[model samples]
Target: MPKVRVHNMTISLDGFSAGENQRIDAPFGDGVGWGDELHAWFVEASRDAAAGKTGTDVDYYVRGDENIGATIMGRNMFGPQRGPWQDESWKGWWGENPPYHHDVFVLTHHPRPKLEMDGGTTFHFTDDTPERVLERAFEAADGKDVRIGGGAAVVQQYLRAGLIDELHLVIAPLLIGRGERLLDNVAEGVEGYRVAEMVSSSSVTHVMLVRR
Candidate 1:
């Protein structure tokens, strides 16, 4: 069966997944000291892999994209746009070819037409519920797994609803005092899950949570 998974969600020691006031210039926002390094390990791992290096962190980083047929992300992850779509010109943060070479459903209140990009990547904007969007993602997955490509809030939605089958978090070594935090207000909903694996590299620590 296909599973819903969240991967490579790097958070700070202060539990912030993203900084405050997200903008086009500052993707993760400001006030996050050393918080930009959250995703540096993934980049480092990719570089290491290109140089024929293999380790636990490298393997974990590479594994996040395996068997992922469709992706679901919040509007924030899509861009800095908010409320209604005043300007429909902004495609996304990624240029011509995005990393997700599959159907990407972006959750938002305002609906828009589907965006077809190069490299077999397409963005479908919808205002549907998380469960409904997830179902659509599964249908598009075509027997493959569905990945929750998030910016904290979207991941929290599915997690609170107990929909995610696996959750992988990359714990950075820094601390952001404010901003969006992973697992925020999810104490009750997180009861059904447990940390199944924890592996630490020199820069960051990787933790995997699976349903009990």
Candidate 2:
């Protein structure tokens, strides 16, 4: 079965996934200079991986993209834009060719025409519920797993609905002190999930949780 998974979601010691005041210039938002620092592990690991380095961070970073045939993300993850579409020119922060080369479903309240970008990526924006989006994602996945590319609230919705089968998080050593918290709520089904694995590197700790 194709599972719904969240991968390489990095949070701070204060449980912030992203900082406040997110903008095009400041990608991860702003919080005591640690906004960009939160993802340093993954970034460094990615560079290292490119240079033929394999470690806990690099392994987790690589694992995030493995078997991911489709993705569902919130508008925040797509960009810092808010409240309807005044500008349709924002293609995303990933430049012409996005990293996700599969069907990408973006959850949004406003309706917009499906964006077909380079590198085989097509963005479908919708106001549908998590379950509804997941259904379409599964269909687009073509037997591969679906990944929730989140910005906290989106992840919480799926978790509250018990839609995600597995979640892999990278807890960085930095502290944001404020911003988005990945596991803020969704307490109803907390007992249904368990920490299946944990590995620690010098820069961060990789934690994997799976629904029972």
Candidate 3:
């Protein structure tokens, strides 16, 4: 069966997954700037991957996309836009071709027409609950794993609902005083999951949690 997984989610030492005061200019917010320090390892790994290099710890983290058939993310992760559709001009943070080269379901209160990008990526906006969205995503995923790409709140929603099968968190060493935390108000919390793997790197610690 296809599992719902979260991969390469970077969080700070103080448990902030995203900094406060998010805007168009500051997508990840003002304080941490999309947790650059938190995602440095993956950035480097991505560069190496582009250069045809592999077998590094970062490579392992980057490879999680190989089995993903579709992705689910919050509107925040899509862009800084809020409320009703200001205009259809705002496609997303990513350029013409998004990194997610597959079906990407965006959770939002407002509805929008399906967006087709340069790559195989297509954005489908929905105002449904996590469970309903998951069902749709699974249908879109066709038997492959569905990845939950988030901005903390969306991940917490699914986590609380006990819908996530695996979670891969990259814990950076730095501490952001305040921001959106991933594990906050997560029902019974991570008690239902167990640490399946832990590896430490110079910039971050990779931890994989598998549902029991």
Score candidate 1 by lDDT.
0.89
Tens-digit lDDT track for model 2 on 1-212? 99999998888888888788777767677752422577778779889888988988888888899999999999988877899888999888788889999999999998699999899999999998889999999999999999999978899999998888999988888777877788888788567899999988998889999987
Write model 1 residue lDDT over 32-139, tens digit each, in one string.
432247777878887887888999878887889999999999998898878999899988988989989999999999989999999999999999999999999999
Off by over 4 Å in 1: 32-35
Tens digit of lDDT per residue, candidate 3, span 1-212?
A: 99999988888888888788878888877666642786777788777777878654556666678789999999989988889989888899889999989999999999899999998999999998889999999999999999999979999988888889999888888888887888899959677899998988766788899998
- Candidate 2 wrong stretches, greater than 4 Å: 32-35
Order the numbered candidates by lDDT, best leading. Answer: 1, 2, 3
lDDT values for all models: 0.89, 0.87, 0.86
lDDT, candidate 2, equals 0.87
Decoy 3 TM-score against native? 0.95
Instruction: Report the Cα lDDT for residue 16, model 2.
Output: 85
Report lDDT (Cα) of residue 8, candidate 1.
Answer: 87
Task: Give the 10-residue window scoring lowest on summed lDDT in candidate 1.
Answer: 31-40
**Candidate 1: Cα lDDT at 64:** 91
Better model by TM-score: candidate 1 vs candidate 2: 1
